[model samples]
Target: MVEHQDVSAPARLRVGIDVGGTFTDAVAIDAATLQLVGQAKTPTSHDHPDGVAHGIVTALHQLLDQVGRSARDVVFLAHGTTQATNALLEGDVAPVGLIGIGTGASAVFTKRLAGLRTIEIAPGKHLPVEYAHLRDPHDAAAIGGVLDRFDAAGIRSVVVSEPFSVDVAEGEDLVADAARSRGFLVTAGHEISSLYGLSKRTRTAVLNAVILPRMFATADLVADSIARAGITAPLMVMRCDGGVMSLDEMRRRPLLTVLSGPAAGVAGALMQEKVTDGVFLETGGTSTDISVIRNGRVAVQYTEFGGSSTFLSALDVRAVGVGGGSMVRADLGARSVVGVGPRSAHIAGLPYACFASADDLTGARLSTVAPVPGDPSDYLVLDGPGGRFALTLTCAANALGLVGEQDYARADQEVAALALTPVAEALGLSVRDAAQRVLATGTEPVLDVVRALIKDYRLPEDQVVLVGGGGGAAAVTPFAGHVGELEWRIADHAEVISPIGVALALIREQVERVIPGATDEQILGVRREAEQAVIAQGADPHEVSVDVTVDPQSHTVRAVASGATELRTQDRSSRLSDDDLHRLAARSLRVPPEEAQVLASTAAHRVYGARRRRPWWRLGGGPEHPVRVLDLDGVVRFASPDARVEQGTVGDGTAMLPRAVADLTSYGDGGSRAPALRLLVGPRISDLSGVLDESSLIALARSELEGRDRREDLVAVLERRA
Candidate 1:
C-alpha cells in the first residue's frame, strides 16, 4: 500500500535526487514553504549495477544530515537519472521479438525495425478475428509455434502490434495474451499508445521492451535502498515530458524517461527561476542542453529514439557539444581554433588544469599536438602525475575570471593562467586573448541553437529571458549576455536545479487518440481517462486536473492531466449539523429549502434526493443508474456542462493552487463548492460530516481557514450551510 503524508500538517519534506554522467545531486525542500532545506552532491558510479543506487543513497543521507532531519521526515521522494538515456544511447538494449498481427504492410513495417526479429499472423485493417483464430486448436498451436521459435532465438520480450490497433486492439490483445502465457514479457502497441501512427507506435512498443530489463534493474536497486532506509514516501521518477510518474509506471514504459535528466533541468528553471517565457540552458560537465519555454509552457514534441521516431512526448531540447569541460584545440587546418566536446574531462579521465597539482602538472608540454584521436585540432597537453591531461574550456574560463571560486569546481586561477600560457604560445596570442577566443568558440554552437529555437518557436522577444542552470552554468552566463538583447538570469542553486525540479514536479499523464469529429462528451471522456491514469500513478484524485485539446480537421484529441500528491487530513471534530446538511443539499440541488431532501449521509460521501429518473427500459444501462444526483457536501456530484475557463478571470490565485480545480458550481456561485476544495485546502471530505450546530459549523469553517485567501476560497461552501 502507498503511504500518504498528512498534508494538513505544517509541512512535509521532499527530496529530489538526480544522477548525471559525472555527479549525482540531491536536494531537500519544505513543500509547504517552498524553501530549500539542504543539498548534497556525490561522484556518480557507473561500473556496478548498484552504482546509481549508491550515489542516490549517499546524496540523500548527506542532504538529510545537512538539514538536521531524519529519513522519516521525508514525505515525497523523486529521482531523475540518465541511466535509461545512457543505455539507449550506448546500444545497451535487449533484443526483442516483434509479433505483427496485420496483413499486407506488416512484413514491410517489421523489416524497417533494425535489430529485431519479426513474425506475422493475420493481417488487415479493423478486421475482426474469428474465434478460431485465437482459441481454436490449430490457432493455439500456430501461436505456440511462434513462441517456440522466439524462445529458441533467446527472445525474452515481445511486442504485439497490428494495423489500426489504436481503434480496435483485439488482435493485438490476443497476441499479447498468447505471448505472456508462454512466460514472455509482452508489450502491446495499444497499451503503449492510442495515436494513429502505426510505424511509430510499433517502434515505441519495441523500444519500451528493449529498455525494460535495464530500467527494472536500476529501479529495483534505488527503490530497495530507499525502503531499507525506512522511508515510506512513495518514489516518483522524472519523465522526458518534464513531469513525473510512479516507479511502477516507469517500469511499464521506461522509454518515456529517455531524456528525463535534461527535462528535469528545464522544469527546474521554470519553477525555481519562475520564468514564464525563456530559453533554458542546462550546462552540464559534458554537454549544454537548450530548450525554449513559450506562453508559460515547456515545448514538448514526439521523441526520436535511436534514429527512429517514437510516440513518447519529450521536452523539445537541442543538445550542443559545448560545455565548461569541452576540450580546447587549435584547428590550424581550418585557419581558426575550435572547441569540440560532447566528451568532457570526466570521460577523458583527466582533471582540469585548475584541479591538478604541481607534481601532476610536471612535464606539461607547450608543443602543438592533436590530443583527441583522429581530430586535427592541436591542443596543449600536460603529463600529469596520473596521466596526460588536455587543457579544456573550463581552464580557459577560469583563467579569464568568468568562473569565480564559489562556482568553479577548482578555484586555482594561477594554475589556470599557467595552463593557458602554453595554449597561447601555440596559438600565437596573449594568455587572456587565448582564453577569450576559446570561450567564444565554445559558445558559438550553443548560441546558434538557442537563437534557432527562439525563431522556430516564434517566442516573444520582448518577454524572453535566458535562464541558466546546472553545474556548468558559469560557462553559459557569458553566452547568455552575448545572445541578442535578451535579459539573462542564473537560477539560485543552479548547480543542482535538475534535482530541485525533480523534487517539485507533479504527477502527470497524457492520453492522445485519433477521435475525429469528437464531441464535447467524448473529449471529456478522454480527459477523465487521463485524470484517472495519473491518479493511478500515485497522484491524488482530487488534485488532478485535465486539459483536453481537439483538432477536428485531423480528428486528433489529446488530454493531459496533472496532480499533486499531498495527502489531506480529516478534521474529525467538526461535522455537519442536520440543518446544515439540509441547507447544503437544497443549495446543491438548486431547490427550495422545504423541497430539498437528504436521502443518505456518511463520512465518506452523501446522497441527496434524486432529481431525475429514467424509465425501466434505460434503467439497466450498463452498471450506471439512470438518475441525476446533487452535490450534498459528501454526496454524489452533478456533472457540470463542459466549458473552457477564460484566462485571468479568476486571478492568479487559481494558478497558484497546485492545479486548476474543476468548478462544479457555476461562476454565479462565487467560485465555491469545487470538488477539490478539501484537497486544495488540505482537509478531508469527512471534515464537514458531523457539525453539531449552524453556529458551530460556521466557527469550524473559520477555524480551518489558515492562509491568505483561505476564507474567500471556502466562503461559498460555508455560506450554503450557514
Candidate 2:
C-alpha cells in the first residue's frame, strides 16, 4: 500500500483536473513540497452541456477520497478543457455585431468570420469623420444608431475596430462606451492587440466577443461545481500560452483558452521531466499535439483561429488527428492503402477489438496469427461478424507488450488481435508486420511535426528529447527510435499530465502599448500595470516580476508580468515595513535614513525619493553638487536567497543589465551552483541563450548601471522562476 502524506497541511493541497474527450483525469499534490498525493480518472460525462463539469467534480471527489482528504483541503484548483476549442471547431459561437470605423472598412468586413454582422460607423483613420468633426454629438448618434441596428439583429456582443486604433484608440473607445450603454458585451480591437494589422485585430476581437457567452456559462458551471464540493480556493483556467489565468480573466478573454489543453500538456512535460529543451508529444484519445520547449521556456506564437491568424500569444503547438483511439482501416479505393485516423473510434461508435463483446464478434473470422506469449491483441485475426473493426493504437501497444501490464489490464488483447487480423490479410501481410505498420503510419504525422519544429527553431538535435504524454503515450514510444538519435522519455503520470500542468501553472499577465518615443516614467507605468494585472489574478504581489522590452524602431513596448500562485500559509511577517524601506533607500544612496522620503506606498512595497550630495572631487573639483536621485524605486520583497530575479533595463545605454544580473545570481550562499539564469532580449523577448556568457553579461550590466542617469530606469525583482 502506498503511504499517504499527512493532511495537516490541508491548505497546501493543489488539485489539477483535465477534461478530455474520453476521460476526466485528476491529480492532487502537496503544493509546498511538490509531492504527488493521489490521482484518479473518471469517464468524461458526455450526456449534456454540463457533462464536463460533472466529470470534473466526479474526478475531484475520487481523488480526494483516495487520499482521505476533503475538498476544503484544496488551496488551488486549475482546469484545462477542450470545451472552447471544440466550440470553435464545431461552429458553436454566439453571433457578434461588429462596428467598423474608418473608410474602406467594408472591404475587409466580408463573410470570412462565422456569425459576425458588420456595420460601418463613419469614414476616417484615427477618429471617425463624425467624431473628429463634432467631437461628441455626431459620433454618439452614429454609435447609438449602430447599436440599435445590432440590437434589432439580435446581437448581444459587439466588436469595434478602427484603422490606426493602435496609435490613437479614441474612436474605438467611443464606440465601446455606446455599445456597453446599449447592454452589449464589447471587445475593442485596440484592447486585443497593439499591432498595426487592422484586419487581423478585428477578426481577433470578433472571435473574443463571440466566445464570451459560451465561455462565461462554462466558467459558471465549473465554479458552481467547485462550490458544491466545498472548495473555496480561487479557480484558475489554463491559457493557450501554457500559463493560467483566474476565472474572471478567462471569462473576460476566452480566446486565450483556445488549445489550452495541449498547452497544458506541454507545460506538464516541462515541469515533470525537468528538461530545459525538448519536443513534447501529447497524444490523446483523439489527437496528438506537438510543442517545442526551448531553453526552459515553451515556445509561443500568435493564435490562429479557425485558419485565420489572430494577435493573441499562444503556445506554439501543432496537433494532428492521430492517437490511441484513432481508427485503423483499409481504404480499398483506386489505390488500396492502410490508413490511420484523422477520425477516432469514439466518433465511429465502434468498440476497439480488445473491448468488443463475444456477441459483437459472432460473424468475425478468427485466425491465430503471431501470438506473443502472454499478449492478446497480437498475432490473431478476427474477420467475422459485427462489421469490420480493428485494434486501435492503444490496443496494438498492449498486444505487443509495449505497454506495462497495469495498463494492459484495461483492455482485452485477444479481442484486439481478433479485430486486426482481417486488415493484415487484406494488405497481404502477417499480423505482426501489420501491427508494426499501423504504429509507424500513426507516428508519421507526429514525426513530421517534430521534424518541422526542430528545423524551424534550429534546435540542437543531440539535446532534443521527445517527451510523450496523454493517454496514448504508449503508442508514441514504439516509433521514437525511428525519429533519429534524440533521447525519448514519457512523463510521470503521462495519462493525466495536462491537468498536472494546469495545476502547476503560474499566473501571467501581458500588456502591450504602442507609445512612440515614450518617456522612462511611461514605460514603468505600463510595467506596473502588467504586474498589478497578474496580482489581481491571485498571484503574490511581492513575487511578481515584470519583463519589458521597447522597440525604438516600431515604438512598441510589451510587458509580461508573471508570478507563482500565492499560498494562504505563506509567511506574511517578512513583508518589508516602512522602516525597512527607508533603510534600503539610505543604503542605496549612501545617505542616512532621515534623508530619504517615502514618495509612494503600495500594498506590497514602497518607493522612496532621496538626494545624494556629491563632493567637489567627484564633481571635477567644483563646489559640492546636490544631485536629485530616485534612489531605489523598487518593491521591497521578502528576501529569498533562492529567488530568481528578472531585471528589465531599458534606455540605449542600459543594454548590459541582463548579463550582469545573470552573473550575480549564478551562485548561492556557499558559492554552490544555484538556479539557472535565462535571458530574453528584444521587443519580442527573444531568448538570448548561447549568445552571451555569464561574465560577458555581467560586464555589460555593470557598464550600463555605472552611469548615474540610468540608475532609476531599471525595473528589477526577485521571484521564483515559473
Which candidate achieves the best lDDT against the true structure? 1
Q: For candidate 2, lDDT tens digit of each residue in 1-722?
A: 96544557453688898888778889997776555668999998878678688898999999999988887778889989888877766666677776666644433442233222332212221111111111232366766676777777777887877777877888778778877787788888888887877778877787788778778878888899889899998899888888889999887799898888788998887655655558998887778888998755788878765455778898888888888887654443322335577666665555567667666676577433222234222322345556535457776665555665444224665665655566566667776677777777777778878889999987756557788887788777546545455678777778778888888887888787777767656666677788789988888865565556666567766777777777422234434455665776565444577875654332333434444444544423332212111212232211221223343344533444543454444444444221223322221111212211244323323322343343333433222222
Clashing pairs in 1: 102-123, 103-123, 575-690, 575-691, 576-689, 576-690, 576-691, 605-634, 606-634, 606-635
Q: How high is the lDDT of residue 521 in model 2? A: 61
| Per-residue C-alpha lDDT of model 1 across residues 1-722, encoded as one tens digit per residue | 95444555535688999998878889998876556778888898787568788888888888888877788889999999898877766666776777666445555654454333232111211111111122222266777877887788877787877778788887788778888888887888899999887778877787788777778778889899999987899999999988999999887888888889889998887656656568999887778889987644588998775456778889999988777777766665443575556567766666777667666666577544544487554654666564677677778777877775567443577778877776777678899988888888788788788789889998756556788787788776654556456778777888888999998888889898887656545665676688789888888766565545555456777777777787433333444566776676665455577865444332333444523343456432332211112222333232111111111211333332223232332244433332212211322221232222233223323333323343232211211111
For model 1, the stretches where C-alpha displacement exceeds 4 angstroms are: 1-11, 43-51, 103-138, 331-343, 347-349, 355-365, 382-389, 409-432, 567-722
Q: Give the TM-score of candidate 2.
A: 0.70
Query: What is the C-alpha local distance difference test score of each model?
Result: 0.67, 0.65
